[model samples]
Target: MNPVIVIGVLSGLVFLLLVSGTSFKPFQFLGQGVIKILIGALFLFFLNAFGGQVGLHVPINLVTASIAGLLGIPGVAGLAVIQMVILV
Candidate 1:
């Protein structure tokens, strides 16, 4: 698929959505979820980077990311504990 065509289609969709004046609640929720997931991934990355010295690591995947994203720091702590328990 051509990048230009994809951009055009997306632009058209955005224009239609904007002109329709429809509720964006669903979109907002989805955007927030995506942002949270990205943040979760970042959290995992840093955990791995700094925690490596302590021999702590958590795999970054959909499940882990969702858990971290939805639950925040405590969620990451839970994952770390789980990993430690499994390792031991």
Candidate 2:
């Protein structure tokens, strides 16, 4: 496995779990979580499509941390999925 990809995905997942714990009360914001996940996935998809052209070489750690910090766990999970897909 590519080290860059591995690091990206792992960091993303860790970010997700960490954010999940702090962001919400759990079980109550399920719908919001789903929406966040979808948005995160879309964000990553677009990032992959035009990352180089846009000069957004955003590192995985930074990206994940930012998303987890701002959007919470679900967002991080979505980003993690995209990162794994790209890496594989």
Candidate 3:
């Protein structure tokens, strides 16, 4: 019942499970979110690039990305409304 052995065994089991894909359920959810984040960020960037002369832009960062990722177009619209309210 040595502490070092216990730690080592637990670490090995974790590593094995991860490598065998048994621990991927949570990561799949996170991974899908990452894809959505990238997509949303790109969508925002596209809008800003195409509409910058009109003052249409959204901050590109983790929080915005996560919001857009989780909520899609509604999230972008919400951000736009908030930005307009703050700027006005």
Candidate 4:
């Protein structure tokens, strides 16, 4: 087969796939999870920055980020409460 023919076929296949409306639920879920984790990390960063004044520091890790990401503000609040309760 000629190289140009092979390349054209591959490109055509790719274009067809793009127009096929394939369901990518898993990828969407994964992407959303990653976005949530990043948002969680940002939240924790700000929390540390401002909470430092009040001696409240929540470590930003995978677990914490997941919690904050999945559970939103309440999760961050819960972590803060746990920290204060345990350390104080």
Q: For each candidate, what TM-score against the reference? A: 0.72, 0.32, 0.67, 0.73
Residue lDDT tens for model 2, 1-88 = 8999999999999999999978766666776666665565556555656665744433444455458545755665566566556754
Ranking by TM-score: 4, 1, 3, 2
Which residues of candidate 2, in runs, are more than 4 Å off? Answer: 1-28, 52-88
List per-prediction Cα lDDT, in the order shown.
Answer: 0.91, 0.62, 0.83, 0.90
**lDDT for each residue of candidate 4 in 1-88, tens digit (9 for 90 to 100):** 8999999999999988876645676788899999999999988898899999999999999999999888999988998998899867
Candidate 4 overall lDDT versus native: 0.90
> Ranking by lDDT, best first?
1, 4, 3, 2
Which ranges of candidate 4 are over 4 A from the true structure?
1-20
List ranges where model 1 is wrong by over 4 Å: 1-21
The list of candidate 3 runs beyond 4 A from truth reads 1-21
Better of 1 and 4 by lDDT: 1
Give the distance in Å from residue 9's predicted Cα in candidate 3 to where it truly belongs: 26
Q: Which residue pairs clash within candidate 3?
A: none
Weakest ten-residue segment in model 3 by summed lDDT: 42-51
